[model samples]
Target: MLELQCAVRRDMLGLADGDSSAYVVPDSLPPRARLGIYRNTATGALLTALRLSYPAIRSLVGPEFFVGAARRFIEHCPPPSAWLDAYGATFPDFLARMPESASLAYLPDAARFEWAVNVVLHAPDAKPLDLGRLAELEPAELGHIRFAPHPAVQLIQSAFPVDAIWRAVLTRDDSALAAINLAEGPVWLCVRRTTSAVAIDRLAEGQWHFTAALLAGCPLHAALDQATDAAAHVWLATLLASGYFTEANLEGQVSNLPSGDPAT
Candidate 1:
């Protein structure tokens, strides 16, 4: 039974030629024809999943082009699990390698931005941080505080103006799309789910680094050290207010800061 299932899946994904002998079918319905129906249905479902996850890509390339690209991607990388939400995670990399997409230099980044948005939207919910807890900590203890990043948060850095491209394409704002300057330097983005919807915000390089460090479970002082900009404290306050973290913990016994501590 396991072998039969594997054979059916391979056939459906076009990974192998149809093996009619593997299945029992009525005389009126050829076994190969029955397999074709299953294959088509499976392909359509996968295509729908990709379209939903990458609407910006579809809009940017048009339906026909998007279909061809998605089909090729599906053929190369079939879904690894039954959960479709996690599918297409590597599609951005695939697009980056596709010869046809080579002309659209920013397409891969745009797809990556979209995937981040998709991931945030589908991530498990996390409790918002209780801001009142911060006031209880002594000043000396602040440096040892470790913030737990919200599960729904995702960070992306792109050389292209992917944020602008995604916004314009998804919203169908032709003028905004045309106004985009591809050479407008790189962008660091924070993608997370808010109370209402997914929010995508561009952050300065310093803030991006600081937030990334915090998200990686670094202590506040350590993360602050990475914030080259003078506004590190301000950025921390803003992130706290935005519910970027779920909890904060002092790394060790709260005591006087060590002489080597960045805070000192």
Candidate 2:
């Protein structure tokens, strides 16, 4: 019975992709519909998960194409975990491989940006770093410091204006999408949750360098050195105002930070 249950779990999850013709008539269901139930349920769950993760993409592709591509994608890459949130990690790659249009090359990057936004919305929350404590740190000790950004913060860089694309679809103004030139390439963006709303900020060239540096665990001075001179202060102010970036020391101590664990 234990082995039968394990086989049922594996086959239903599509782990038995190679061949399971021999087991299709197992006594799980009436012989007439033995494996049909598993097939329907598994496919339905996969489609639902793909839709949840890529609603914008689904909208872009219309229901028919979206369903077709989703079915194909699921066959190649089954969900990795039982957790729904963990599904759809490979969707962007699957889209990028489609030989549709050179001009539509940006679609996959847009999908990736959307996925990152979803992660930011669901990430755990942490209190902002204490400005006073940071001010007292000696310059030499800065390198040893490792600060944690808000778990709800996500940074994404794309070779397309994915930020603009995301906004066009989500905004009320339908004409906003008409203004987009697919020829335009590249955008760096930050997605973070603040005041109970998830917002996406498109970063300028200089801002991208600065934020990327900070995210890479660089020290303040080092990150500043890497930033465009004019953007240094602006980036610092933005980071602080966003309420991201918790000091490494205060991480485990939930008492030190506000809203230690965030909602999914």
Candidate 3:
């Protein structure tokens, strides 16, 4: 009987949406009263997590809309894990399909940008390559080198100038009125937590290409060759100064590259 009661409560809390009539243990009011409590608790926890994940989206749509959308979201896609961070992975897509809110074309992209920011904040940081280590590598040796960026580094490209939209919303003042053509080209964004704070920077076309190439594991020389501007070293220096790349693995059988430790 206790096992049966546990199952009923689990269903009530949405752990499993089973047949209500079949499972209704019509014994006493107190018997299933606890089940209702569990259900409310489960729903409340999910609502809070969703609100935290998409505060900007909440602000954009207002509280009533956010809660309504969240209820629908919980019903369709119950979180598969207890980890709150992993709970809202489907939220951006959910926003895209919200019937009443579908008019806001930019909403999905803005939510996606916010998700990227959240991802970056949790990623690990690392030290960038030093100049001396880079100088020691032979021309042929540049090909096999590998690099690892700080775990927090993320590249977000969106049709909307989402970074601008995000900034406007965050600043709470729409005073800086820059006309953004929603259909205009996508903005390539670099999101990372550097020395000061979590930052979002808009990448120029050339810089975007350069970063993309590097991210794709291209060797330094090849990445530079493919870059439009061709001033690869300058770009590399700029990024290094900005504390982007943390680990530089040189090519060839050499056990180690020169320590570019900014600490030294």
Whole-model Cα lDDT of every candidate shown, in order: 0.87, 0.72, 0.75
Name the regions of candidate 3 deviating beyond 4 angstroms: 1-15, 18-32, 129-132, 177-185, 250-264
Evaluate model 2: give its TM-score: 0.82
How many clashing residue pairs appear in each of the predictions shown? 0, 2, 2
Tens-digit per-residue lDDT, 1-264, candidate 2: 676666666667666642444545556565326665767788898899888888888777778988988888887887766887768877889888866523467778888988997888667766776666655556676544545677788888887778887788867357888888776867778888887688888878788778777766665666776677585777777786667677543323433322333321
Higher-TM-score candidate of 2 and 3: 2
Off by over 4 Å in 1: 136-139, 250-264
RMSD of 2: 4.6
In model 2, which residue pairs have backbone atoms overlapping below 3 Å? 159-186, 160-186
TM-scores for all predictions: 0.89, 0.82, 0.79
The global Cα lDDT (0 to 1) of model 2 is: 0.72
Best by lDDT: 1
